[model samples]
Target: MNKRVGNQTVRLESKPRIISTATIVGPKEGEGPLRDYFDTILQDDLNGEDSYEKAEKSLLYSVITAAIKKANLKEQDINYLFSGDLLNQIISSNYAARDVDIPFIGLYGACSTMAESLGLASMIVDGGFANHAVASTSSHFSSAERQFRAPLEMGSQRPPCAQWTVTGSGAAVVGTEGNFPYVTYVTNGKVKDYGIKDANNMGAAMAPAAVDTIKQHFMDTGRTPDDYDLIATGDLGKIGRKITAELIKDYGYNMDNIYIDCGEEIYDAEKQGVNAGGSGCGCSAVVACGYIYKNLLSGNIKKALLISTGALMSPTASYQGESIPGIAHAVAIEFGGDKNE
Candidate 1:
C-alpha cells in the first residue's frame, strides 16, 4: 500500500501515469528558446480577446481540450479537473472549467498551483478515488502585471530582480494505465515568510521556501540529487536559483550539477530581456509538460524531481506592507514506457 513518508511526503505505490499534456503560450513566450516545446503559440498576448483575463481563460480552455485530445480522451472521460491561475478569484480557471463542463476543483497556491494540482490529481488516481483526472494551471503576463504590480498603461519600470510573468497555460492528463511518466511521490511544503517586503525581489522572498521543500523531500525519500536525472524548480529565476543552491548547501546538500530551474531554462535571458527570468503559474507548468514530459516520453530522461515554487503574495498584501510568503511543492516522476514494447 502507498503510505506517507516522513511528515509531508506521500509515496504513491500505484504510480499514476501522466499519459498526455498540452501547452499554449503568447507571442513573447513563443519567441523564447522553448518555442518548439509548446503545443500552441498565439500570435498576440490578447489571443483575439479584448481583455488579458479573457485571454488567460481562453489559453486554459484550449490547453485542457488539447490535453484531453492528446490523451485520446473526451471531456466526459475526466473524473475531475484541477486548475488555478494568478488572477483574483482564479477567474481564468473557473471560466475555463465552465467551458469544459468537467467537475472542477479550483486551487490556489499562487504560482505553485501547477505542482499542487499535479500532486492532488496523482493522489486521487492512485487512491482509486478517480481513474482519470486533469491538472492544469495558467498565467498571463498582462493580467499578472495588472493584478500584482501595475497596469500596462502605467508602464511601471521593473526592478532588476523582478521576473517576467509567463503568458501561457499547461495541462496534463493522468491515469493508472499508460506507458508514460508516472508520479511516484509528492512532498507538500509549508508557508515560509522571511519578512522581505520588497515586492520587486520575489526571487529572494521565495528562495527559502524552495530550499525548505527541497531539503525535506530529500530527507523523506532518502534520495540524493544523483538519484534522479534532473531536479528542477519552477519560477525561481536566476537570483532565486542561486539563493536556493546556497541555502541547500547550507542544509548539507550539494545540488550544483544535478539541479536546473524552469525559470532559467524557459528563455534566453539576454535575448528576451526577461530580467531575472520567468515566474507566474504557467512558468513551471509549460516547461514540465512541454520540455520535461517530452524528454521522459522519449527516454531522454529516466527519472526526475520537479519542485514548483510560488510567492504567495498579492497586491493587497503588498499594499498592506506585509512580507511576501512563499510555498513550494515537489513531485517525483519516473518514466514508465510501454510495457509490451
Candidate 2:
C-alpha cells in the first residue's frame, strides 16, 4: 500500500530519502560587497599568481570535501556527482572532483545549476539508477565579475535590484533509501524572458520566468495554489516575487498565504541593504541546503516547493543585444509519515 503526505507520495515498497547539505564561504562573516569569500580568494595573492581557474578550483575543492565530511559520507559510497559552476568548461567542478575518488558528471544551467542538479538527482533515484547521489554548484564574485564584466575595483554602482554573486559553494547528498526526506515531484521550466535592458535589475528580468513555472506546475499537476503549504521561488527577490504574484493572479491563481521567495528569506532585507533579494546559483543552493532542509527534518514545515529561477544570459550575450533568457525548475520536498515513525 502507498500513502500520500502533503505533496509527497510514497509507495509501500519505496524507500524514503534525505538530502544532507553543507556550505563553505571564501570570505569571513560581516563583510560588505566583494569582501566575502568569493572576493577574498579571487583577489588575494595567497596562491601567488593563481589564475581565475585556479582560485575556483581551490575554493570548490575545499567546500565539496568539507560538505562530504559534514554529511558523514565516504567518497566511495557516493554513486555519482552532479556539479556545475559559472566558469568556462566548469573548471572549478572538474578540478575539484579530480581529488575525490568518485565518478563525476558535469552539468551546466547557468544560475539554475542547483535546480537542474536536484531535478536530475531526483530522477536518478526515482528511476533506480543509483541509490545515492550528490549535487553541488559554486560561484565567486571576483572571478565571475572579471570574466563577465569589468575588474573588481571598477567602482560600478549597481541598480537597486542587482544581486551580488554569492562567493560560496554548497553541496547536498541524496539517498534513495533512508529515513531522509524525499523529493516527491519536479516540474522542469521552459525558457522565458522579458525585454529588460539592464542586467542590474535581475528580479524584473526573471519575474516572467518565475510566473510561468509556477503557473505551469499548477496546470500540469492538476494542483491548485492552495494545495501547497508554501510556494517558494529559488532566488526571485522582492521585486520579482511581487511581479510573480501579480502575474499568477492574472492567470487566475491566488497564492497569498503560500508564497515566499528564497532570496528574501535568506537575509534581512534591511540589514543586508538589499532592496529586492539575493541572486546567483549559490543563493538557492545554500538556503535549501542550510535552512529549508533543516526545517523539513525538524518537522517545522511539512510541504514546500523549491522553484529555482535563473537568468541564462552572459555579458557577451547581452552586449550583442540579445534578450535575456530565464528558466525556473521546481522540486517538491515533504516530510512526515510511517517512515518517520
Candidate 3:
C-alpha cells in the first residue's frame, strides 16, 4: 500500500501529513535543571502502585499540554487523540488524556508508538475523516525499570551499550494537506532480531531494525542518502548508530555526512552517565518536537527523514529466551519549497 513519487516515497495508507509538532518536559520550562527534575520525579513520592505508570502519566500530560500550547488550539477542537505508552493497557496515556475533550484511540507499538500514531493520524486527515488530529507517546526511567527489570534502588550496573530511558514526552498535530510541513515519505519495518541476551545493550538488539528500515526506505523510493538533508534515527545509541552506518555502507549508500541519531543528540555522553545514548519512546519524540522542529522553523535544515526504531521484546519475552524483535518506521518532513530556499 505504498508508492514512490519522484524522489519521495509515500504510503497510500498513511496520507495527509503532519503540520505541527511539539515536545515538552514535564517539570515546567525553568524548573531547575532538566536532569535534576527527572531524577527527583523518579525518586520522589508518587501516589501510584506502579512507579512507571505515574512517570508515564506525568510525561504524557506535559507533552499533550505543550502540543496544545504550541499548536494554539483548544483541547475541545481536537476531534481525536491517538496515543500510546509502554505500560499495560496504556494506563498512563489514558489517565493523562481523560481530562482532554477529544476522543481517544490507544495504540501499542513498543517504542514505535510515534510512527503508529503519525501514520494513523495522517490517514484520518487524508481520508477526510477528520481535519485536525494529534499523536503522542511517552516513557520514563523509574516506570520502565520497575516494569521491565528491577526496582529503582536495585543499584544494578547497565552494560556499555545500555541506554537510559528519556524522561519526557512528544506530540504532534496533523491537518489537511496545505503549505504546512508535510510527511513526504514513510516505510514500515518488519520485526528483526539479533539474539542478543543482554538487556542493557539495546543498541545491539535494535541495530538490525534501524538498518532494515533505512535500507527499505531507499529501496522503496529509489533515492539515496544524498537526497535527504539529514537522515535521523529515533533512539539508536552509540552502538546502534555505528552498526547502522556499516549496514548502510554495505547497501551502497553513504550516510556519513547527513546522519543524526536522537539518542546521541540530546545529552552529552561525558556529562551524563549514559554510556551510549538515550532510549525509550520519549527520545525520538522530544528530539523531533524540540530540536528538529526548531531547526526546520529557522531554515537550518530541510528535507529530513525521521526513523523511529523500537525493540519489540518485553521482559517476559526475554525471560522466556525469546530473541528480541525490532521494528522501525521512517517519516520524511520537509520545510518550505524552492521559493523559501
Q: Candidate 2: lDDT of 333?
A: 73
lDDT head-to-head 1 vs 3, winner: 1
Worst 10 residues of 2 by lDDT: 32-41
Q: Is candidate 2 or candidate 3 better by lDDT?
A: 3
Model 1: lDDT of residue 29 = 86
TM-score of every candidate: 0.97, 0.84, 0.87
Clashing pairs in 1: none
lDDT of 3 at 331: 79
Q: Give one digit per residue, the lDDT tens place, for model 2 in 1-341.
A: 22332342222224336557766544421243322212123335223336755765676666566666766778888888888888778888898889888889898777778877877777776667777778888776667777766787897776677766666667777776666667776777788877886777777778888888777777766677766667888777888888888899988899989888767765566766656666667677766666667767887777777788888768878888987888888777777752221
The lDDT-based order of candidates, best leading, equals: 1, 3, 2
Number of the predicted model whose lDDT against the real structure is largest: 1
lDDT of 3 by residue, 18-38 (tens): 666766543321132233322
Q: Judge candidate 1 against the unseen true structure and give its global Cα lDDT, from 0 to 1.
A: 0.91
Give the lowest summed-lDDT range of ten residues in model 3: 28-37
Candidate 1 residue spans exceeding 4 A from truth: 336-341
